[model samples]
Target: MGLSILGLSRFQFAMTTIYHFFFIPVSIGLALAVAIMETMYAVNKKLVYLKMAKFWGKIFLLSFAVGVVTGIIQEFQFGMNWSNYSRFMGDIFGAPLAIEALLAFFMESTFIGVWMFTWDRFKPGVHAIFIWLTWLGSTLSAIWILAANSFMQHPTGFEINKATGHVRLRSFMDVVANPQLWRAFPHVIFAAVMTGGMIILGMSAFAMLHKRTQQHDGDKVFFTKSIRFGAVVALVGAVFATGAGDLQTQFIIEDQPMKFAATEAIYNDTSDPAPWAVVSLINEEDKTANSIEIPYMLSLLSYHSTSGSVKGMNTVNKELHEQYDAKFGKDMNYYVPVTTLFWSFRFMALSAAIAGLASILALWFTRKGKDTLMNYRWLLWIMGACTFVPFIGTTGGWLITELGRYPWIVYGLLTIADGVSPTATVPSLLFTNIVYFLLFLLLGAVMIFYSRRVLYQGPDGEGELPAGKARAAERTSPVSAQSTGSVSGNAGGTERSVALS
Candidate 1:
């Protein structure tokens, strides 16, 4: 019954978190893009720029709403489903979460409201500042959350309390400055940027394709610039994400050698040089695997020296058991599921590679002009469909990071089985899992519906300053232009010759 409850609780948390993250990358990425667009509009005073900002801002708001709704439940689940884990690490983990809520979530929500309502009232510069603040808030929120997660991967600045059997915060700065956090944070930020860029690229491609068929220039220039901007940003994001991922791998090799070995399916210890497995067939019972490998590459990549030795999973596990067993007083399973980690790593790497190549191709096609971009129908179709690639990579990367931690909920200090809530029941966990899944399903549907509606409407609907001001100016402007048989221009300079009643 205890194991069943633990499994259910893990499933529930994983489901909720995965759903929450579906919207998070989109929200963060879109926030940055919208902020950039608003900044450009404030400086250039271009109506098209304003249109772009408002259009994308709508999608960002929808994503943010869904993300927040899904995120709120995760907090409750932490206390209810895994009370033991919460109690064990809450002292150290709760600090960053509290800061996230107080400093980041509040700031983001408040500024978003101010930015939304003050569109017509505030000056363009002030309005842009509000959106920029919102993006900054979102980024700060991510940093704090990542800081907490990093603590789980590499426990630092905390000492275990022998009396209470709980971890206590020893150095706040160490928790915040964990090497894992800094290495992982940049990768997450870059991935968010890439996700945002791909969304813009895909949506702009759709709009452009629609305009081509419909013979409408209403948003041609807007989406043209959007695609170009997205391409450049995506290129930069993909490049940085790749570099950050490499650095993160190096860190993992140094900090969590067992995870690295398991990820590569290296079961036996090797010295002088080690081969990087491209693919492997593992027999868990026998503790062996047959693999296709590149000689010396693993050593070269892991230590930056071809001659450096790389410890295998078997050696690392034995050493971990010997080192920790005496202190923890329990048999430990240090080896994570190699199959899951191995495939997830590959999926993340492949998806990122594809996104990078697509961005480069997009930049190339858009560099010449819109006409040249349109010349390749296949490329446009690919761009329009490539929006989900970053999300895939982000999801897979997260799975690898989280799952690689395995039995230990807080690295070497705590096991996940030990962290399960003693009072949790199987039926309650199962019920909540179903409920949360259905709740997110409904939320996801609504998000999709609203997104489609906004995309269909384009940027010509309400909240457009030029269109609204033009109508207002037309009503009060001199009647001589209306009464006189002559073409007249209002505040927006679009020629109009009509007699008013």
Candidate 2:
């Protein structure tokens, strides 16, 4: 096994990332949705709007807590597992990362804490502002983190520090403002929105599926409105994600040709024309790809011309080795993991296609008091299936990215083998691995179970939730001036809805 250190680190990283991502999309989407509903309530002086906002805000709050905890772990892992990578790219990557920490992360974290414990204490108008602040911070945090990753794919505006064997910032502005960022970040944002949408739609569908027995008359109406809201938002996000994904494909072909070749399983080692394989492809093998393919699809994606060809992985690998030797005065291994990148890309594409179609079709069938078509048994089944699609999409995007950067921990500067602690023995790694694996398993299960309990057993269970919780009541029922005036807040607090807004 030589060590399995790489395998272990990869596993731990993936598990942590997947778990963290599950919480984020919902937090970002729900925050905005809640803010809009609250604003509507304040404007119209309608309690239904307030009830709607508070109920959904409760769900968002749950997602935020889990997201924050899981996210902190991801930041620490970069330093823990890939310390060498951090040292090498720290100057460049650390810029956006630091900004995210200072400008976005702390702001969101602080405001969220205020929002959570002070609903009864804050003014209604002021509280709404804090919510919006949290929402912006979350999304901004995403943009900065993504800016760092974009630099990896298209290593822009950095100078080599030969003495340190690392890249230094030639211009911090250049690293942060790469053109690649504009595309990748929006694509990720839309994907996040889609994940949020599916969760909303999936829950709404579950309620609808069991409509006859819903405990409260108000519950059915809320679920119906949510279904409309979710299906529409999901469809819009899906369409944006697909378009951005296409643009990303084109960008990858030009910026990381080897990765593009590896992803498509192009092994013939030629250029000037590229073919898009439409199905599964066998790698590190002889004979042709076993799949349907469009002869010039890759060409158009790569060069904006039907006749131009994309390079193959074999040829690109050979060239990379030659280039490494020529540039560094030494032989080097060009290790690109084909299978992981290949499957992850396909999974992302396919799942996205299905999610987009499902959302749109669901809306068309159910729109404008026209849900009979959506009442089809299969549509319900697909809606249920949509709950897991975001998980798949997030994981797929992650694997394609991290796997594509194999061998090198930080682009051309450091390899994974060089990143491990020399004094850290295999026995030590194994012990830690076992501990982390068990701990992680327990943590993941607890989060899922807790979240499910909140979703399934809390509202729909036997008893009604306690009143006087502004945010909690908002989600379960339409809030009125009655709710606003119900609480005698603590001294230095608003009269209605106790905790400080």
Candidate 3:
């Protein structure tokens, strides 16, 4: 099959972006988690909390490092693959990215280093401040990044320069304060938090299982506390994520009705008090769907009541053609990938519900002197598997956000066809795509390897963990002098310092 430059460029970008985004939420979420763990240690001076902080901090650092590397590559693609889009959006888009790099990223990286290296140097409370700062910085970084993205979605705070045929920033405050940004940012942040919570809950569950098998009572206690903490965090994130997602969807109904319409696979104008499609058999060629819908649910969801009519794809497309035909072209297609949106929305929503349910069950089973949790091996398995589920939800949400925009790169201002770089060749794009794919595979493998290594090693660096199932704890008579006092495991002669370990 032949690869057009535009198609290749889009594919390459999609691959790189998806891979990059896989770690962004993880990093942001983990930063908060690590900070919370450290703060708990600071507040209680509990050795278990200290162990929790150190153990999870390793994963946080790894995620942050990989995210930074992938983010650099993501930024480069803007210039390399979408030069025309960059040239058009540079004045509007560049500001947030610049602030993110110079202010937010710099603050995050610096404090992260401090937190890592000076763990023992500062008092507990002071050292904890560094991680809290890192979390704040990472959060701020997300805000700036989303601010830039929101501008593309809504295109506010800018004026189209007639002479140059480019958008110019009219007000920085307005761009940063975009209503779309506020509506979307909470959903993303809470999702990130949920992502973090799931990872912690899963890892802790696995650790608990391993320790229980080994009959290491101390380790089991450590993991039990951690698992419960993770469950609370997960539940909070999941609950807020759902609420925020609903609010964002409500905004989308007004702001981007076609996107909302496509998500439900609605082609014809809906009756007043529209029905919500639970499932659909969509025909792309015919632009129609055979749906199983719930009465008035769509109207309730869209307008917070069961009264208003929701516009459908066909109706919106016709209106769009009429409005933009003179300025753009009559042949412009406003239709998006309906099937993808239909499935993605369901998957995203379902994943969030699953996450919430798992968290709730975990909390219930482990409640008030209940030793029943361990007996439910299936529950543990579900919790562990949930580590990967939030990624699916986040990925699906992003797919809807970006792909639903479809023909527009900077909605209404520029089309995706005209945004790609003219000079990008098929061969070069293919080569880079292959290279980046292989690189991502390597990164993924390394992350898995190291993460597993950390899990196997447990909170205590007493023994080297084998590649397979949990092994018996090998207690050493002599403790390592360099080992941190906070860790519960007996540090053997082979043990390294906490920071290095």
Against the true structure, what is each candidate's TM-score? 0.88, 0.85, 0.92
lDDT of each: 0.76, 0.66, 0.79
At residue 481, candidate 3 shows an lDDT of: 23
| Tens digit of per-residue lDDT, candidate 2, span 1-501 | 236766666565666676666677777777777777667766776666665566566667666765666666666566667677667777887677778878887778777667655656766677778778877888888888777777766678899897997889998888777877887877878887777777777766665555342655556556666666777677777788888887887777766667777788776654556677777567454524565777777778666787787777767777777766665445565646676677788888877777777777767776776756334757776787787787788778777666676555555656666765444455655766676667667766866665554454323332234554535545443233344422111111000000000
Q: By descending TM-score, how would the candidates be arranged?
A: 3, 1, 2
Candidate 2: 10-residue stretch with minimal lDDT: 492-501
- Worst window of 10 by summed lDDT in candidate 1: 492-501
Clashes of each: 0, 24, 0
Q: Pick the candidate with the highest TM-score.
A: 3
RMSD of 2: 6.5
- Show where candidate 3 strays beyond 4 Å: 211-213, 463-501
lDDT winner between 1 and 2, please give it. 1
The C-alpha local distance difference test score for the whole of candidate 3 amounts to 0.79
- Using lDDT, give the best candidate's number: 3
